[model samples]
Target: MNKFLLVLLFSTAMLQAQTVVEPDSTGVVKSNDSLVVQKTIMRDTLKPFKRYKAEGVSAVVGEYVILDSDIDKAYVEMQSQGMSIEDITRCQLMGKLMEDKLYAHQAKQDSIMVPDAEINGMIDQQLQYMISELGSEEKVAAYYRKDNIADLRKDLFEANKSIKLASLMQQKVIEKVEVTPEEVRTFFFSIPEDERPVFSAEIEIAQIVVDPKITKQAIDEVKARLNAIRADIIDNGTSFSTKAVLYSKDPGSNSKGGLYTGVKRDSPWAKEFKDQAFSLLEGEISEPFETEFGWHLLYVEKIRGQEVDVRHILLFPEVSQKSIDEAQKKIEDLKKQIEAGEITFAEAARKNSDDKETRNNGGQLVNPISFDTRFDLTKMDPTLSQQVYNLKEGEVSEVFTDRDRTGKSSLKILTVTKKYDEHQADYSKDYERIKKLALREKQIKVINKWQNEKIKDTYISINQDYQDCDFAGDWLKK
Candidate 1:
């Protein structure tokens, strides 16, 4: 916790690219602090930071330098992490700061202005993620020296500005690059034979998803029923909890009287419901609203920072057999059109599919785990996987009754457009995989080229302390 130890930890972490941003911590070290500098480096290496023990600057890059205190403080923190200063770490820290200042310089020249509101929202998102990762807001507060997360908003302003500008510069550098299938094959074959990755059994699935339609009359009836329940709670002093326990159909929350706790702002729940829930003042009851489940009335119970707890009464619309048959019939017709060569499956999906997520992507069911347009048979639903297992590639299954992810009963037709067996990747069978790999390689190459070009144009300087140390890039050389 002391300055000397903190510097050692940071000094070691610099080897791993860890503590470059918290420059203020360096101010705690003695101007001539040689203890950590001596400790971090072996007796052979020149003590670049130790000379600053009594001086104004440790190392300079263009107009920027790691101050004596900052560099030495980093040395102590590096020691704490069981690391020591070396040419690589010293270069990395200096490189990181130089890159940051470069972005800062260019962003100022461009007169870029990322609004405070946007920056604050990003800060909140970061804090929320940290809170989730660290186990509590209190822990995050302790880490950041804030009594509450809100205090962090203004404090991270400069960091956010640098982040935004760097992002903008990166986008400008790598916009509009595209890769083709041949490029994909080349990229796959270029991999070293010994390092080639093997792949698992996977499938590419497609479907025509139909929503069991809820007629307008059924929707109105559900809404009317929810409104009456809300009236009883608001005007008659009835408890929201009692009505939720008795009427809510959501199995997950009904046992708890439909109360959801520790709900973060960016939850994966339906956007409309989450937005309305967060919009309400505490003790306010929302009017009847519909989500994927059905109609609902929500009452905000508590709000804490970016998290919320809410109680709701949920009701499903009465879906008639006629509506179900109509959905099935329409899908049957769509299937016939595809079979008759009147429309492609992808065209039909784009124009008429009910599932929005896959509709835009031509109905291919992408594996969320690997981000592949495939799924492993072992991981798939037993019943559905068995039904799909016997089918050959390019074969479409008969229309079958199934429930969508939202648990709505509907009819769908499945297609296994592509299939891959368990093996090391081959260019012939894994073009999708190759395309992604090649595209990323191209993007990375483009970014590196952009960075080198920018570094060449920028005014740069390094203090004599680090002038002779071998750094990774020509970052310091004009």
Candidate 2:
């Protein structure tokens, strides 16, 4: 049997029948079956058997009772690690389940539904996150004993959807919650000054960027070279991987025989790269193509659902000194115009900047920490930070060299747009911030109320074993 199928079956069996018994109340049954307890059992059964154990007395909702197998497993695992299971069990598991039950009940009451699109989106996101952490989907699948991500997607999707729905319900319940100016001040005062989070002093900056222009003829020449190479590989019966290893300029994957583990559309590779990879059928080779990274001959190896694996040989066209000199002179001329007031910095950026992301925003650089125009000079690029550290507001930086994430070097200039010194936060300075906090508090209350109502009405049943554990909400008497 497939490992994935086994997990799914276990989950279904665990949730199919569950009973809830209220603690400290006799002959008081609210509902007969508890979804919360059933779900918990499913999670426990799916975990590795070596770590399996039961923790805390169960809680009865209506007709359903939920159990904490993970907590039990943790207790037993800790015992194996030389900790006292009694102390750990007595202190944690039961309380935790009570909290989870309250939240899950609230989620159902608020009608927090996870749409199919949301589930699929989350699955993709998880897949990408796993790839980043494990280096590839193949490794992750091997570790989990699954054939592929699709086999695991359904279970992951359901679990994630349930958690998301619960979170949404919490938000809805707390929508009107708030902590006022006084509350903020009190909370701030309660914390020790030494422990307070220090706000970085920052400056706002802006810039104009340009790429050294590549002529159509130069691009065509590079593509023609790649085309020749691809033709040789196809006509000579040479393996694609061998050719890529010998000729590909993509330093990251070339050594691995130009093999790219499957990548999603958003997997940090350029859109052009992904588009070209997906366009080719498995085993099909693409003609030479030119992108920002120069020219490439791509070979699509396999298509796995939404992911594609490909190999490519890349060639970077060398930039001539004349081209660099020309670009530098143009930038210098633009700076002179700004200084002479022939064109305002904003106007110049709008008209000539190559940085599409920020040029339209008046070339103002965003603070990495706050994402606002404001930033602490200390947290900026070491070289650029040093320049801004010495400049007064409104000063334009001298021409400096920098490289982007792709390691492409370029010449650029920066202008300091705004500066803010450190100061204590207050209502006047942070009303919008305070309001958001207050609103979250309100939402929590609403969710709590909704949960109480749902538990009172939903069908729940706890097993006889959990009839005596104290629950936070009135699950048995409702």
Candidate 3:
């Protein structure tokens, strides 16, 4: 479906679409059967498949049992992503599910604690994207076969907890992995010559960013406008949902009546906004409150503990041409200083850049994937990629408007500080790239060993129907 999930959760590419044959089970789905299973199969009342007394267990990893219904859910998720389904693919899928269980079991044993905020943040990001794409919360709910967006959010929270836990465990497993230059060379040469990967044309780019400041006048104007709308809602009895659709600037939330559910108090939302949020009682609409990105009026729909499900009407302070021009002027000045050698890009960035992360580091943009300052060519924004692709090293790009993390329009100029072309993988030139791969290989080896050991110590069982495919960790053996 939407590979738009921030994590590399389902990135396997265009495989042939194939159906997973239904395993022989007494649990044939009935006519009245619905796909509206709860995210969890309830703790005490485990195995809702009791009705399908015929529905057999696929595998059992410690306390976590993989039921026929669970496998069916996985198959449907894969099918949504257009995955190839065969015994091999099914085994791979089973392996992944079991890995999740293994990590979860170990995490509990090790007393690993993942904060609620972290999980809530990830879930919110995905929900925001899904809601934006689907055009409304109603659409998102319907797509997931949920009663509403709140239910969808609850499901996301449950799913993401395991994902986050497994991720944290994986990170801890590889924390100590180290690879030397010698190891990198040995690993590189170990690959068959014909099978060696061809390097893509890549470049290292840096930028000086200037956030367009929405003026005090714009803020006042927006505040006054929202005040009127809020008045209409409370004083004149206008529908809060109706006003949200027409006026809210948050694309992800506007069509949803500017509502979000399961918002954890510890989440990264602006503290002032969140502080005001939790203090409100249900059906209480607060006065206009200011956050970093404009003004908002809170309408608390529901609250449970630290989580608040609320609808709000957001009004972004409008930016005038004058505001845009001012930002452009600042970047152009910085550009001139760089061109004239009056100051270095690093110094200008430190003194003036609005981008916090890059400002301290010479305005160098890190590749989101590699988490390094090098660009992988293809991953760069198409417009940004094309512009710098044609420029020589040491050239600076013209200032242009780009969206920041919070979606604020900002003026930015990129500098091509370094460039590399497609070639055979070389230790001298591709040291970092090769080193990363080599290090990851070492980590994988470590993780695999740990996984095998865990499997040996933990109880595991697989149904005879699923035992044929190749499984790692001696799954079919010990």
Model 1 misplaced regions, further than 4 Å: 1-145, 153-164, 176-204, 216-221, 236-283, 291-293, 298-315, 318-353, 356-390, 398-409, 419-439, 442-478
Tens-place lDDT digits, model 2, residues 113-226: 666665564455445445545666677565445588666565455544544554455545545566766766665555455443334567788897766766666777777788
Off by over 4 Å in 2: 1-138, 147-149, 154-156, 159-198, 245-252, 261-275, 290-294, 304-307, 377-384, 426-478
Model 3 scores a TM of 0.76
Q: Cα deviation of 376 in candidate 1 (Å)?
A: 7.8
Q: Which of the predicted structures, 2 or 3, would earn the higher TM-score when compared with the native?
A: 3
lDDT: worst 10-residue window of model 1? 23-32
Model 2, 340: alpha-carbon shift in Å?
Answer: 3.6
Q: What TM-score, over all chains together, does every model reach?
A: 0.52, 0.63, 0.76
Q: Counting only residues 3 or more apart in sequence or on different chains, how many pairs clash (N, Cα, C under 3 Å) in candidate 3?
A: 0
* C-alpha positional error of residue 431 in candidate 3 after TM-score superposition, expressed in Å: 3.1
Best by lDDT: 3
Write candidate 3's Cα lDDT for 100-212 as tens digits: 66776787787788777766775565565566566666886876666897786676665556545655676677677899779989977776665555677789887888877
TM-score-sorted candidate list, best first: 3, 2, 1
